[model samples]
Target chain A: MAKIQIIVICTNLIFLAFIARLIIKAKLREEYAIVWLLITVLLALFSFWRKGLDVVSKLFGVYEPANFVFTGFIFFILIYLLHLSIVNSKLQKSITKLTQELALLKEQLKETNKSKIN
Target chain B: MATQLLIIIPCFNEEDSIVSLLNELNQMVVPNTFIITVAVINDCSNDNTSVIAEKFSVVVINLPVNLGIGGAMQTGYKYAWENNFDVAVQMDGDGQHPPAELNKLLQCWHNTQANVVIGSRFLVNQGFQSSLLRRWGISYFHWLNKFFTGIHIYDSTSGFRLFDRKAIELAVQYYPDEYPEPESIVFFAKSGLSIHETPVIMKERQGGKSSIRHFYQLYYIIKVSIAMFFSFIRK
Candidate 1:
């Protein structure tokens, strides 16, 4: 009923719809889109059940519900960023390996061609 | 059986020195039982480095993109691994690591059977010993490595190194990218490999700027320290 709750609900609905559009267009992978969708749906749930967050926060032994929400989101973001860095490291290793392999193969090809000419 | 020695010289824009370096390397004398091959990993230099290197009998690995010093050197190691080289030496492209004194490193390896024989400029305290500031930086890594790996490395950052097949195999498997010399020493020590230091003089870089520039000293120390710490903890 609160204006803030109504705004939160509307925003999450729009975000969910946007994510759906992205998935349908094949712009976002289902695994990655699931993370965004889960966040939006959880936010919507908290907005509708105003007392849910307070209860959850109390269960988590946090004095303030707002603090709990901010900390949770911070933790989630940190975990997501860590995931991204792991992905980036793997990508870098792959690229380095690929580049090295290609260069070596090219050298071998050149040697073969040289021997053939002889 | 003849020993295959690969001199891996990773270069970036060393157009001024590559020709002479290769010439000197070509003329260096090795034991009749050892067959030496020079492989230069051109890190996508925007100069004539690769062109000149190609003119020599040495193998030039022209990287499509610049992979910095660590990646470039690893490419050379990979080549050595692939070609079944018995020994690999990492020398500088800027002519700082002398080709004539290479015998000392190879002799040390043969005598002590160390997995790695590092050319330490400080062992005899001669040749281009680098700046006072760089010496202090080198000492910091030395102590840091001793603390983590329990191995005292005199010249931890020396690029002039000889790696036997075991060390070469490990390097080809996993090597740190950027500022790898000191970090790799720690890595080698932690991997239960024997390392020996021999006194070999190194000259001032003939041409091109040193990879660790004036401003990057602080970042270099920090990054290498972190890399060493990770190496210590890694399985």
Candidate 2:
């Protein structure tokens, strides 16, 4: 194997270990950690089995395997960003609901206090 | 049960226009059979809008953060739903929605028994048309709504609307958070709710800049169209 491939494999393995530790420590939910774990595993595989990526890219009629990898990376980033946005939208809706409820409750409390003073 | 009406006015930095609008609303005559109240949603305005709104004896919901018109109006709907209001009406805080025509909207709502009643400017074109560019945009959405939802709404962008209890409930549960007016029409129609429009003349806004400006018009059109498309495709 080339020196660069050795370095890539070691880096991917370290990343996988770090994410595994995060999952075990309960710092990340398994549902989300699975995606990161899978990504790290794929990177390790690509580094060790460099010919595998080329073969797959050739089978898919991609002219350049590096282009395929970059495209795949961009596609995954887009999907991940979309997922984050969906989660954000749900959080925003809930926060708005909470704020509205709090305002109404405060008003009711003020009104009640006024009547008692009267 | 007697009808309980809640008028929801969403204000965003409308310190210049809110007081006069509130005064106009206070003087408007509502029917004796119905109980009426006003709720001003102060959408985290950086001005004295909330203080002025409170002076009018209206319920002021001071939002902790600014949630544009859609979020602000949804807060109003949630309030109406929780308070057991029978009907809810939305009017702009910029004094463009004439309080005198509010009675007309309620009449239409009562007569048609529709789930939602909108005060339309193009129904008879009573000489309060918007700018030429805005008119063209409104016309495009009018056609798009008719084609997609099969419901012809002359003024889909008009914020002056009265909602029945069912409509209020639905809106509280699910409402668009941005550019809600036109997209909401599609949502209501797709959900099998009846919508009726009545002729009402709109006045030019007295103060505050429009939320949808000239530069953002394209973005507004594209976003609303995509939202409407998704509403159609969703179950």
Clashing pairs in 1: none
Clashes of each: 0, 0
List runs of model 1 lying over 4 Å from the truth. Answer: A1-6, A61-63
Report how far residue B230 has shifted in candidate 1, in Å: 2.9
Cα deviation of B128, candidate 2, in Å: 2.7
Write down the TM-score of model 2's second chain: 0.98
Candidate 2 chain B least-lDDT 10 residues:
B59-68
Clashing pairs in 2: none
Instruction: Report the Cα lDDT for candidate 1.
Output: 0.93
Off by over 4 Å in 2: A1-30, A45-64
lDDT string for model 1 (A53-102, tens) is 99999999999999999999999999999998998999998999898889
Candidates, DockQ = 0.71, 0.51
Full-model lDDT for every candidate: 0.93, 0.91
